[model samples]
Target: MIKIVEVESNKDLKSFIDFPHELYKSDPNYVPALYMSEKHLLTKHPFHHHSEMSLFLAYKNGKIAGRIAAILNVNYNTFHKDSVGFFGFFESTNDFNVAEKLFEVAEKWLKAKKAVKIIGPVNPSTNESCGYLVEGKNEPPVVMMPYNQPYYHDLFLKMGFHKNTDLLAYLIDVGSFQDKSVKMLDLLSQRLSKRGIIVRKVNLKYFKKEIAECMTVYNEAWDKNLGFVPMTDEEFEQMANDAKMILDPDFCLVAEYEGKAIGFTLCIPDINQIQIKMKKGRLFPFGIFKLLLGRKKIKKLRVLALGVKEEYRRVGIEAVLYGTLLKNAREKGIVEAEASWILEENQMMNRALENLNGHMYKRYRIVEKAIL
Candidate 1:
């Protein structure tokens, strides 16, 4: 019989983090996360400030079979006014019996915590890389993204989960696509200035203050968005620290009007360029060399986050942000960029991207099921 075990000690938690290493041992498309990074993500990560989660492992006849985490986002529920729980950090062998036990444990714990509906495969939460690959199985996931076997989708569906919303990823080939976006950005920037708005590179000397401005806009602008959860000060700080290593100052821009921060965009070097060389997300001997050597070789970018504070909405701030990022990319000789995981219902952002010629290239889905 398969048995479900709660992760209680460091050793068990290590097993929970390392289980996927064995599960995907021979899968070429799979990339292993850094052992230490994942451990901290599970146990001591700053995300714990606003959310509570428990990790579990499933063993079948003494062999690891599956793993998952039950997440209770108190802040998310408070913001959305609903008691919705989440399941994330999920992975498993092909045995449905083991999978069922793992799922049941998360459901029971969440139910006891008073969660009414369960949604995800969110790794932790939507603020992080969230979703299951429902399409585009041939290409591996980009940096800081999730990848899984095609069969996992079947398992979730059989367990009664339905798609809540689909997330989109668009790809532009720098080598091929004519740079209409890049060419027009200067004109767009000038047009925006005439409208009383200006876009400028963020000043690193005031990093803390600028990030604070962003966090405030985030909380206000995204308050009513679907599956939106406000980031705590700790969470925002955690994210900032992670981005410091790869953030290009020019590529990170903010739009202002009369001196207050209103809109912003962050474009990160597709670390997948280096991540592919990373082998196992580590910084040891050869890893650092590969990263440094591959850094300049990175020609792709991910427009990681973009927001316009409420008062600045629908005033061409987004166009300015988009225009500015493209302009910086062109100057740096980088050709392609991805503005991703936009919620299907977020028509405003969608239109802004399409207006710049980005194509819908990849799709991921967030699925949910009520535990019976």
Candidate 2:
């Protein structure tokens, strides 16, 4: 019998967290997320303030078949007023029956909440990890990104899901991108300097204070995005603390207007390049040694997030951010980087990247289906 059980105990919760590891154990491209970190994300992350979610596991013939989470964000509905629900943390054996049963559980839970539309594979929400990894299947994901079996796409399509949005990931070889874009950047930046706009690496001494300024701009910058949810001070602080561990000050750049922060770009070394090699996703005993030793050898990065406050959207801040990123990459010996999860509709950011000669090497999509 295939039975779906709500996670009601510690043992069941552990199984839910460990399911993906077991399912992807044989896949070399699969990277295990840090156990402690995922636990907190699902359990104690401050996102719970505006959202409610529940977890479920599918068992078939006494074997773990799949897992999923049903999510309802009161804030999301109120903002867009779309009555949309989300399903995330999804994983399953390569079986149509198993996937249907898992998705049914998510659908049922959403229906109970009066959600009229269902969307995602969005771990919990877009404010965190979101999307189904539909392309670039040959390698593991960047740090804090999602990855899954290629066949999973067919599973969702069969389950009546269709594309709600697509996110693009751009790849740029550091030495090559800098070489190609440098001259134009140099010329343009000089133009920008004459207008009093300056590009520079972040100052660490007042990092926290700067983050506060950026936070105000962040909410304004992305306010027009689909499913956009502004972060609370607590949530931003927590996320910043986590990023501080691996955040390269050089790779995080800001654009100033008369000494005020108008835009920022942040990237981090793709630590998953090392994390996946660790196999078990631990940072102890041998894992810590591997992480420390492997950091320098890994040469890829992810341009994680970027924003230009609404008042300063056009003009040339994006190029300034990219130019500053170029300087950082040259200094750090980074060979390549991925600027990702760009919404297909975000033509503004897309044009900025293309102008820098970034190629859309990978694509991911969020799918949706209506139950009624």
Candidate 3:
């Protein structure tokens, strides 16, 4: 018989976090999440301060068969003025019965909370890693992106879920990328300079101040995105601290006009290349060395975030930032970079990446179902 159990104790929570590691063990492209980071996210992240989430695991014949988190994002509902709960941190075996039971329990919990609709695979929220890999299963995910077995898509469909939207991941070949924007990098910079706008690498000396400014741009820049909820200051700070550890200042750039920050882009090395080698995603005994020693050798990157103030759009700042980032990556011997989770309908950003010869190699879906 299949049983669904709420993750209430420390032991059960550990199982919930570790389930994916075991489920994807035989999959060559699987990259395990860092255990410590995952623990913090589940137990004490700032997200818990404003939202509610309950984790559940499916047990079949005394073994973990699946796991899911039912979330009621108060902030999301408050911001969007809608009644939608979320199901996230989902994983399962190839058993349709197990998947259905897991979601049944999660949906019941959200329904009791008075949620009218359920949407996700959001890993708790849109501001974090989300979406299920529905396409491009041939390769591993880049840093901070989600990946799942091909069967997860089937599970969602069979369980009455429908695609709400698609998020796109673009793979850019740095060595061969040729675009007018790249060729005009210098000319663009000179022109922007004449307008008192300058694009420059982030100043690590003033990291805190720099991040604070970037946070402002981020909140404003992404306000219009689908399902976007402005991150609280605490949430933004917590995220910034985590990124700071792996940040290469050269890959972080800010565009300023007359000393006021107007736009920025942040990229980080694809540490998944190193993390994939970690056993159980543990950072102790050996994983730390792999991370620290392997960072410089990583030649892949992910453009985690790039945004500009609404008023700054179409000012050539976006092109300048992309061109500069590519130039930096090429100089560092970076072979590939992925600018991802771009909303599929964002033609302006999509077109910009295409102009740079970026190929949309991966597509992720956010699926939803009615609960009320």
Q: Which candidate is the best by lDDT?
A: 3
TM accuracy, model 1: 0.94
Candidate 2: count the clashes: 0
Candidate 3 segments exceeding 4 Å error: none
Question: Candidate 1 on 90-205: residue-level lDDT in tens?
Answer: 99988777778888899999999898789998878877888988876476567677888778888988788898989888775544545454667778778778877888888889
Write out the backbone clash pairs for model 1: none
Clashing pairs in 2: none
Clashing pairs in 3: none
Which 10-residue window in model 3 sums to the lowest lDDT? 134-143
> lDDT per residue, candidate 2, 126-192, as tens digits?
8778898777747788888889888999999898899999889998877876443465777778877
Clash count, one per candidate: 0, 0, 0
In order, candidate lDDTs are 0.80, 0.84, 0.91
Model 3 score (lDDT)? 0.91
Models 1 onward score TM values of 0.94, 0.95, 0.98
Which candidate leads the pack in TM-score? 3
